[model samples]
Target: MILGRDEANKALRAQHGQRGTQARRAAAASVIGTTIEWYDFFLYNTAAALIFPAVFFPESSSYAGAMQSFATYAVGFAARPVGAAIFGYWGDRIGRKTTLIITLLLMGIASGVIGVLPGTDSIGIVAPIMLVVLRLIQGIAVGGEWSGSVLLAMEWGDQRKRGLLASFAQMGVPMGLVLGTGGMTLLSALLPAESFTSWGWRIPFLASLVLVAVGLVIRLRILETPMFAAVVAERRTSSKPVTDAVKHHWREILLSAGLRFSEQMPFYLFTSFVLVYAVEERDLSKTFVLNAVLVAAAIELATIPLFSRLSDSIGRKRVYLSGAILVGALAFPYFAVLKDGSALAIFLIVIASMIPHAMQYGPQAALIGESFPTHLRYGGAGLGYQLASVFAGGPAPLLATWLLHSTGTPFSISAYIVFSAVVTVVCVIVLPDRSRADITDDNVYARTPGKHRTSS
Candidate 1:
């Protein structure tokens, strides 16, 4: 099954019409699919912070309601690893295109169901339980979607621009942030407070159905990656790729999760938790914070690609570590700016903060994807990436909420951010660096110069 170089080229050439054009199409599909999926996902984050406690947990006091709501939000994060395992197996076995399509549908439908669900008044306890279940479905679908989108984009493009192509998949986070936050802001502004809470919130969730339809059409037209085709032609795929990834590449999986602690934890704090902190504590307008976060996300649309492109010349580890440090350094100052409560200062700092995040996130897809070969890449990358949701991104709002009330100080949350940065810096130093190695090696996993193979 180890084809000669010529045969490998033939297999790749045989699978598609034009390599350059298809690669672009694949990247486009990745952007659209990931954007739609994250739009659905971010809607939940925004709602959990701004809308859910009042709707689903109306019986509880403010603190208790917020905590309970975020706990449901965290349920989705807890389910991500399981999703990674299930979808990773199918994605690695059948193909990225089909697995991604399944994930898009699952996420879209879950969001739509949330849109129609009865509130606590209508359904009593069943309402919150149903919400949690749908959140889990959303989490699982997203857990699988991220790596597939990245691979669809990265594997189809020129190897030398892996960082840039990988960032195309990453573009969804900020773009979706803008769309979700913008949608929420627009509705809240347009409707009465009662009406907005009761029904206006559901519009964004319902919109996901239409977006998913468009994403499916784009994804269907794109072929599977040539790299994956080579894997199939070489007959190199495992029946249980997710299991093998955990069994053989546990180090990569764990370290990859660790590397995102700084990135993911702070992202939620900035985008989700800050909305609560600004409105409840600082007495800032909800619309103002939402608009500020919206602007920050738009800025990342530029910064994410720039930093990722820079990683092509430098290294993934370097860009990522620098981001971790910068984000950590900015943490204390970020809150300090909020404490000052100048509208201009808060907006300026909020917009400036996401650039550091882009530095880590832009290069993140390829950085993790390079840890495993094509046969195991989907499951391996997905498991590692999604595992962070449980410990990092998912718990961030809950943790920030707790820290705020317990310590009665904004700086307590900043300390938590710094801890995440420390973990990330230490983890990246220890994880393998394969940014320069050949990613398309089918016979054996590629190794860096002066290295033979990765140590178990």
Candidate 2:
């Protein structure tokens, strides 16, 4: 009897092993779903910087229109935290898979609607108002999307490769950037300027529908994460996860938000604001700036995964802090390089900027997700990450543009980047490295005596 039981247990373990095909499929689903969602979100950034000012917000001066359009873009970031709270609650209370599916559907519909929206020429003031509303919907959807993707991929793998698996989801950022920029680049090249500005810009937004269809099929088929399943089996799921996360994991929440400052600021500067700066300040062609962003995004596709895998070996903090420090050091050089007005020089600058951004972003999901216990992980990570969008990501382009316009130089933008980087380094120093922690439960609460940890 004892020999028969031992054999049955071994067979069961083999059947349910995480290293099997199911893990790979789950990881793929996380990446695919997020890639589609981000493709939709980022499509807006490209439009806000390039096409929206003329089409949606017609002001007395081009600069005013561009700044106004960017303000609308910031509205989306403002709404993100709201989305995080709503979806984060459900994601923690129910499951990651279900919440992710909802977010994907929401983003697809909003983006497709934007494609068909009439501009200021046709609809008067209503056009920009409608644009801001749809952008908010997109914001909420993306606000919910990131935490679920991170947790879904991270939970499917064991500790040994957790950072690497979590980064499979992070890869979606660059994938979306490539798709958004590549599509815009192609259409802008193929169409004449009038046609491209009038209708061609809508193609990328409309394309979100098709990607969402495929993402939905894949996401619907994947299983709920094993960590959440175990929580359910033990009846340890939190009823109000968002509230609990605020009360218990507030330090992690603040630290995660702070860590995002440098990462998020340089990202918008590199990808979004660079178009305006290069064209208006340096007299560079729009095509050249777009192509630069495309190449940098492509390089990130390789670098993000490489850095993430490195984190799995050395440590998350070392990789994250190094990236933060690099951003500060390069802040001044970034402006100096751009002033040369050469295409090759701008391309090199764009590509170089992504290296530090990816180094932090690659391992960022696991770093934040691991800080909280399993039940509150979704809510904690989502709130922290989305909150950063308000202070860091949303204001970055607007601030950069204002500084350039006010000071008549890029030095203000450089100072801004350095300040944000300092905040990130400080947060990195304070936040604990939980790379080896068992996140399967709140079990760590018992192990850390006198710590303010909580158990479900």
Show the lowest summed lDDT stretch of 10 residues, model 2.
Answer: 1-10
Q: Pull out the clashing pairs in model 2.
A: none
Go through the candidates in order and give the C-alpha RMSD of each one to the true structure. 3.8, 4.8
Score each candidate by Cα lDDT.
0.88, 0.86
- What lDDT tens digits, residue by residue, belong to model 2 across residues 1-456? 011223323323433863466577788998998899888888899899889988987763788988898998999999898999999989876688788999999999999999999999898989989999999999999999999999887887666888889998899998998899889989988999999999999999999999999999998776677677666555566777898888888888899999999999889999999999888878888888888888888898899889888998998999999999999999999999898647788889888999999999998988898888877888899999999999999988998888988998898899999999999999989988877777764666332223322224
Off by over 4 Å in 1: 1-11, 14-17, 442-456
Candidate 1, residues 133-191, lDDT tens digits: the string is 99999999998899999999899888899999999999999889989889999999999
Best-performing candidate as measured by lDDT: 1
Error of 2 at 416 (Å): 0.2
